[model samples]
Target: WSSSLGGVRLINAYGPTETVITATCYDVPRDETLPDRFRGVPIGTANANRLLYVLDRHLNPLPPGLPGELCIGGENLAMGYHKRPDEEKKVFVPDPFRPQGRLYRTGDKVRMHGNGLIEFLGRVDQQVKIRGFRIEPGEVENILAGHPHLETALVAVKTDAHGEKQLVGYFRPRAGSRPEISEIRAFMQKQLPPYMIPAAFIELDTIPLLPGGKVNRRALPVPEDLRGQLSAEYVAPRTETEEELAAIVSSVLRIEKVGVYDNFFELGGHSMLGTQVMSQIQEKFGVEVPLRVLFENPTVDGIAAAITEALTQSIDEEELAGLLGDVTDLNDDDLNALLNDE
Candidate 1:
């Protein structure tokens, strides 16, 4: 409200150097609409005698509410930059709908929300399809930056041994602050949709930068281990129960090398996932770990110890004969579900 003390109001505007200056404007004249937040703030409707287009890959116009590359056109458009004809040719493509006219591809993905107001999603190049989900790395980065101890975040894709694409996140903590991978993951799991959550996180002293001060993405190191979450220290599973729990957790969570000390809840476990874990533990070990046990013993070491203690008391070998029937090739989840039912 301190900003309103001055008679002059602030206006949100958008344009590129190619447009010389502002070409679009957004004004929130109402006091009630004083503050507005955008995923990436929408550059409002076009300015006087300006044209904007949200188009598909083929340069065909897209319907409202659909995200596509933004194209700019109008009399306000400037000619090609000096000694930059090659770069200009790439963006200044021929507009099919407008005879002999050209449109500047902005490389920005945006959607029309309501009326003619367009909301910026992210850069078109930043959008990647993961498991059929169109993921904006900036969206994931935004969630990571929301972490209490984080100073900044970056999300990018990497392929593993089999050439499967995976989302990996890199982060830097605030000065003199240390945060665990589980803590950051828990924060992200709560904030972002599951598909958008990075499968792995890597902490960095600093994000690699190019000579021009842009991110040198090509320089990001490929993690050899490919663990779901990278920890500063390596702790292995000790007991057989711990090992099984580690394997099950890693498989179920799509993470790699879960240690005995890792907390399930911190590793993106919710109530539904807790139920599956309980059932799987029951089937695999032929032991019934009550659902409440998960909350009490959330860590691998604690949960494995509790499972061992339970098996020691309820060693019903005769009942196990029938319950363990034909489990030769059953998957972990199915086997656990079957055993839990018995």
Candidate 2:
């Protein structure tokens, strides 16, 4: 490794904000890969006097080789984030292993090794933000892996040429089995939200792995198009409202094209993204649409009708307001005029 780096020493450091700075360092060897190289780099033992503890979600210390959050309790650890008492109290809890001592809960998922090293696993919270929506890719992968045709699955976030983040899934099939992308997509649609479904699927004979047995994600090839598994024929938007709504959903979902009659939920929309879609419609067309309206009318054609209805209601309300003329009471003649005008 030093030969590629022109003969320089490289050090890997690990710590949390609560620790003020780094608490451990690893001197990388040239040929032998570190025993604890996982999430990014190996977090070696605590330096000097600092103590590192691996504990489960309930703050119970786990035996070596079990995955848990790495908690730090030592002199080097700072009290907590300043002015973030609510957050501070959540992470900096009384040490379960040591009586009356403070332990900083590092959100990182890691497992202790028998060699006195810790390997990073991943974030305790696997939620990933893509196009303003916090998505859980693991949830999608779990659904994909559950398919009988699939052996294993890996999901990742990829950016298309349009600068939009899209979820892409890669999977390997069982021996003597070949699964269609459309079949996998139909399987995912049964339980997952539209946003969680991958925009593209790539089949692999075998997943590439690193020397450390981790997936070599960078080696995976990019899919050619955004039309992952939706087998519908191309249908253009018929109305101006349909065209506008399709554009919004396509951009949000990172798909190249969408149909006017396509179900928004079927196209990967969720509650939070539904709010965005509704907000944009209101801003663009000057009509406030309730969240339930979108749920009830999921298609572009359906929503366009709702928009027209809202506008007509607004016109009727305005006419009624004008006829009343801010008066406290309306006579029969005034009410009759308003009714006749309608």
Candidate 3:
């Protein structure tokens, strides 16, 4: 029951009382892990007399790697919620395996990994599938908040008249800062999987808070006119580095005539492809730069300037060394070698 502080990973757990403290527990590791960020470790295995089944809406067992509602059955099932038959009906249902025994409808959507460990994807209510891919908004929001300049982030999915889902991100800049939209999108590109990246970003002064002081997600303003404000007509890059940056954007965005002021992510670039563009740029220019810098200046012109500035700094160091005699203090080995050469 310990509270989490900075650098602490929070793992919220749930299990019915009849199952004893908890029949199962999940351990979410600190930020970075090998394969995926959302994958968690199971604290215990299914013991005898108890059964855990992940099922679809039809109560049929789901195949592995697929997400479905979790149903808990066996001897540890609760008698039923007291004094409320309707409430009891909501959670307690007849088990398919036992034929007559009640099963607890946990309402949690989970996917069983190969090792028998379940990956919790949030409640069925919050679970959303976009573009035929299941998406957990909380997972995307968590990745965005890890950025140094991002104070807060919120992910929302809206369906169009055609019922096509579109992911949107709302964020507030940290104190003493206003970062470029390109930068944030680029940062997200590295942190999330392809489908998890938001389609658009909206800057907010503050996220509406509910009566309980939690995020008032329902009250979030729609992004109908927000796009026109964040990005106006494209601004062309002014420097040689900006030209190079524009080239990268042109390739990824498929727009030959991109302005230096145009945002990379705004023009169809996402986190997954953003990494590709970054890798290409690094290989082309031979410089190691921070991912956070993209958030600071997300346009081609901005990236070019950053690259040019870095290159200039390197050149300045070399020029300074040449101007001031040899940079080396002249170790005995070097001095003797120099004398021998003379």
Candidate 4:
């Protein structure tokens, strides 16, 4: 767009109202061609007389590429908010670098590049802690939007039925292209860690937008069930052990059904939930499955096999054979009844 404006220099300016408008400005290069994975344009250097500091929670400066809160100090800084002293005290803090000077905490997460340009990561308020990892939804949204089949992508934290927070991806497919949930999951898996991958991908024809053109997060529909959005196909339990394990997983994750090959973490299972699963496994299977085992195996079939191995080690071959025979002879109702009895 800047290239089309023959002689005009397009500058991207960033600032909050508290900073008296523009604090930092970036000169957009006329011949710039954005890369496929471009996260965002740099906010550039501080304006004249203004100081930009990318600082950690302690107001200590962060090294390049390390994300932290953006704090502004120096000349252009506002005195304070009008009659909002309590709020002012929260955001406007005394500058450790400059005695008697105040820095406005922008509440914006950013990282400085080696070139001294600042890259806006996202708002600090938008960051969510999931599975003990601090994640910026914009990071996932940026990667998900890079998928060939997606037109746009948005990620938000939604609490699942298990009272656990889970990442849910909402996306609009490119014109005339319908992307499979499994394909989207695969695309994200390659670029993200297991915990970062969304538990569900919901297709949207158009992402709801507010009058001001921002995404209407409150209007986004909640997914009824996440099982259909998983990367794995629905593979029913083939054995009594698998059936029991699947039931436990389904109940814990609050999903309708869990396939034998379905991943536990992919279904929003975290370390905290893994402990609960281990407790249930010991109670129901009469064998101790460590929390690490669930993380390592992370599948109904794998956990069932682990349980079988644990049980086998505790008993003789003849006893194991008899137990297997007894389980194989039971129907679904009888098995459920037996498990309930246990």
User: Best candidate per lDDT, number?
Assistant: 4
Question: What is the lDDT of every predicted structure here?
Answer: 0.75, 0.77, 0.71, 0.86
Expressed as tens digits, the lDDT of each residue in 1-342 for candidate 1 is 436565566567977777657867877453544223344445788898778898998998888888898788878777876899999988888877788777888887777765888876668888788666778887677667657688877778887555656687888899988998778877886777666777678888978999999888778766555444633245798777788888887776666677776666545454567788888888799888887777787778888889888876776765676566757668999889987999
Tens-digit lDDT track for model 2 on 145-239?
77888778888777766666778889989888898887888888777766677877888878898999999987777767544445555578888
lDDT of 1: 0.75
Q: Which 10 successive residues of model 3 have the least lDDT summed? A: 37-46
The candidate, 1 or 2, that scores higher on lDDT is 2
State residue 207's C-alpha deviation in candidate 1, in Å: 3.7
TM-score of 3: 0.50
Clashing pairs in 1: 228-256
Off by over 4 Å in 3: 1-12, 16-23, 27-50, 82-87, 127-152, 158-166, 172-179, 186-199, 203-207, 224-342
Per-residue lDDT, model 3, residue 52, is: 88
Judge candidate 3 against the unseen true structure and give its global Cα lDDT, from 0 to 1: 0.71
In model 1, which regions exceed 4 Å deviation?
A: 1-22, 25-37, 41-45, 58-65, 78-101, 115-117, 129-134, 146-149, 159-164, 174-180, 221-342
By TM-score, the best candidate is 4
lDDT of 4 at 176: 89
How accurate locally is residue 231 in candidate 2, as Cα lDDT from 0 to 100?
57
TM-score (all chains, Cα) for each model: 0.56, 0.54, 0.50, 0.82
